[model samples]
Target: MALPTFTQRYEAGDAWLANSCAHPTLVQDVWAADMLAPIPSGEEWLVAEARLATGYPKLVRIRAEQRGPVLADPVMDALWWLVPLGAAEELADVRQLVVQAAGWCLNCPPTGWQVEGRMWITRPDGSGLLTDPAVLAAAFGPGGYRLATEASR
Candidate 1:
């Protein structure tokens, strides 16, 4: 099934945020596109995707930093996928999916794209950090991923 689309407001803001957060070396290499761009020959890229508060999806791409040639660059190891918040049949299912995604991201070698302290769920209304596995499980558990105080902090 096709993943749900988030609202346009969320998309715009996310694009802006992604560009603003880009590493200094990648200032000219950043792009905000609906779909990921093809990696150029001899160039490495990192891709990350997530949904905004308005339920809009956003994708960020960054030029991967390379060292020596064979060494893996942790900052360049990227992943992109979507978990439809509206598609979950139960709270437990949502929690499970999130945990699994976070775990997968977190377990990658240190030379992999770091998600532990950087991943998050953003909305035009609010946002939540997804660094802690326990926090994710608790927030997405019985409460259904929306807590009143989680906005913009």
Candidate 2:
């Protein structure tokens, strides 16, 4: 299948996130300024955070799922993936993955947008897509085949 272009992804992300929050206008405004806006996790989805060192490889190994949304903060050396609601616990065992469920907020930017060292490495495609925690863990699990292959690359 053909992937969505940046414009498509941007529209999808903007529309989806605008509706996800209580104040749509505020979210829009924040994004217009190229600033990170806080998005609450739990009710809709959870966030799986990992160090750039670990998360980048896993994301590369997975080839970036159509529904998988990922964000990166260069300044923080952190990468975040949006996972299904209640799936945070599933990725808890992955050494560097931090599962942020209810009561946690993720700072996010518009799809295809970067601001203050934060960028959307992968944006939400607006197809109700989310990373599968099980798959993420398996791909990054110790001694996994992908690691050996990726290491040699």
Candidate 3:
């Protein structure tokens, strides 16, 4: 069987995000992206947010596969990462990290589509893969932005 095309993969990811979050409808082959969608905390995923200053650098340190779903909000000057539920407590000590727990709602862009001045820095892959809290916390340091390659050297 031939591998799935980019559009197919994108649609799969889009479906996954919708089911995981707001379950927005698709019309005219275009996702609903004019407004932000609310993503609830707890159950399946927890959102870990950080200032753009810290978030960008952290991504550099974590492995691509481990980074998971991340949302970049230029207007808010923030980056949001989706991790497994309970990440909030594990990453609590990380100064720049704000791991949102149950009851919070995050305005997010639809997977593979930018909306409301927000875009996915690392869109969800439809595999239910979430960033590990320990890896995220390890990324936080006084050392500043260090590339993944530099970390090993």
Which candidate wins on lDDT?
A: 2
For residues 36-102, write the lDDT of model 2, one tens digit per residue: 8887877677888899876787687775542388889977989988888877667777777888857
| Superior candidate under lDDT, 2 versus 3 | 2
Report the lDDT of model 1 for residue 18: 33
C-alpha RMSD (angstroms) for model 1: 16.3
Per-model TM against the reference: 0.23, 0.85, 0.84
Q: Worst lDDT window (10 residues) for model 2?
A: 142-151
Candidate 3 weakest ten by summed lDDT: 22-31
Every candidate's CA RMSD = 16.3, 3.2, 3.0
In model 3, which regions exceed 4 Å deviation? 22-33, 143-148
In order of lDDT, best first, we have: 2, 3, 1
For 1-153, candidate 1 gives per-residue lDDT tens digits of 864355544444344323323242232232321222122211111222223321121111111111111111224342222232322233244423321222122111111122233332222111211123233334435543443354435
The candidate that wins on TM-score is 2
Clash counts per candidate, in order, are: 6, 0, 0
Name the lDDT value of residue 109 in candidate 3: 62
Candidate 3 local lDDT, 70-91, one digit each (tens) = 8898878999888888888888
Q: RMSD in Å for candidate 3, one decimal?
A: 3.0
TM-score computed on alpha carbons, candidate 3: 0.84
